[model samples]
Target: MDTQCGDLSAQSISNNYSTTAPPEPVHSTGAHRTEGDENAGGFGELTELPIEINERRPTCLCCGRPQKVCLCPFMPVRPLEVSTCLYIVQHPAEESRVLRTVPLLAACLPPEKCKVFVGRRFNEERNPELAAVCRDPKTLVLYPGSDAENLEDMKVDFSASVHNVLIIDGTWSQAKDMFHRNALFRLPKQVQLNSSISSQYVIRTQPTNTCLSTLECAAITLSIMEKNKAIEELLLRPLRALCSFQLQHGAQVHHSKEHLLRNGIYDKPMPTNKRKIKRMEQLVSNSTL
Candidate 1:
């Protein structure tokens, strides 16, 4: 399905929300450099050519995931078409992660529905499309703040229009910096999901029970807004499978910061400087989940 700006509506979506969707082809591009032929004086020049890595050892073909931790079988066979469109503003550093869930989420949705913009700050010059979407009145940014309203507790009715969900993909500190530096993010109304479910990414530690991975947050928010229980349950299958694979491969289970603190098992982290203390405080206090 091709997505056009201001063309999405909940009434157009099928109530069953289940249908066959053809797999979208994933493309990879890169360039390789090699030494050119030696000249008469035994001097050589560099040459560049378009190259595609056909080696099957590092990456799996079925899913774009690394061969070491493939979770294709656990993922849904087709994309779930919903009323809400997910706009992810991902940190540049997150793309290199071996087990990140954004790729899985992207693979599960239509290419146009799950748009990602990778950068630290966005403007009309650098990212005009994103800036325009952020300016939409129906768009809502999922950031927690004292003045922000709870997503589940919103007093207004949303059955009449489309919703654009903007999520920042990064760790606690990176997300904070992204949120502060980006003026476009401040234009939308702020909302948050207050969920009791803990994160399924056990290999990585989270600062609070309210904390969830980008995938987890997206799933929960969509399920609640669309009022479809199956969305959250089915969308999280890859996360469970990935965590299981890691655990079997000798990865230690990590407990959430809130759990460890409440049980008196977490050590009191001592900050060496005032800057470190502020960052730590922000992490501990962050509850955007």
Candidate 2:
């Protein structure tokens, strides 16, 4: 990939955003039904909801947030466009999430600069563009594997080389599964952020100490690679404000699940078999009837 730096210094910002909300549920009365209706005697002639409940809410296009929690006002005036490309392999499930950071990241960069590929498996045939970037010699995958090198330790000639940075956007387990299953990801040199700075994603619970939101991870990586610390602050402005707004409006400040378990503030439940035995027994008895 060519490092053709454009004149992004004069980029203009816009604040226009959509205002929409989840449609309120309208109810109608009908017969109730139970599970396993194929076996017969499942229908109940009682008043019940006839309409299917739709949980998905309308979102603002600019911020990709629910109208109520839209963070467009807090977004930066202009995105800090960089020379390096950011390839985000996102789980398809993440698209419907109300509170996601990918949109914010997208808003900060040009479409070509930040590319998102959504799927469970990223094969060369399915995603040729992503595969090509992964195959590039300068490309690096941001992961904390045993053989991973710290971001700061790996020196790069920015002017001579434009790196294709691969970031997997998902929960810890989902990301791990994607990384393990995807052969393309395995080819790139893995890099990790060794800095001790804590995550500012207060609205969501991180899994571990090193875990970060996709936006935060990308911002930090860009800041380090571009040698401009301002990118981190610029990208995070809306995120921080989003968390603050949510906190003020009754959202609790969440701690990582690991932190909660370690501090004894919350306990990990027993194994699935032990925990669900009673429920399973009751379900079996009900089914027999």
TM-score each candidate.
0.74, 0.72
lDDT of 1 by residue, 248-287 (tens): 9788987877677566787876669998666556546653
Give the per-residue lDDT of model 2 (tens digit) for 1-289: 0000000011244433323332333335774544444223322222222433345566677766667777778777766679889998888778766567887788888888898888889788888888899999899999876889999887777657788899888876678788899999989899988777777888787655446789888888899889899988898888787778778878898776556655667565633785455533433343210
| Candidate 1 residue pairs in backbone clash | none
Q: Which stretches of candidate 2 lie over 4 Å from their true place?
A: 1-61, 66-68, 272-289
How high is the lDDT of residue 126 in model 1?
88
lDDT (0 to 1) per candidate: 0.72, 0.72
TM-score of 2: 0.72
Top model by lDDT, which number? 1
The segments of candidate 1 whose C-alpha lies over 4 angstroms from its true place after superposition are 1-58, 66-69, 261-269, 274-289
Residue 143: error of model 2 in Å? Answer: 0.8
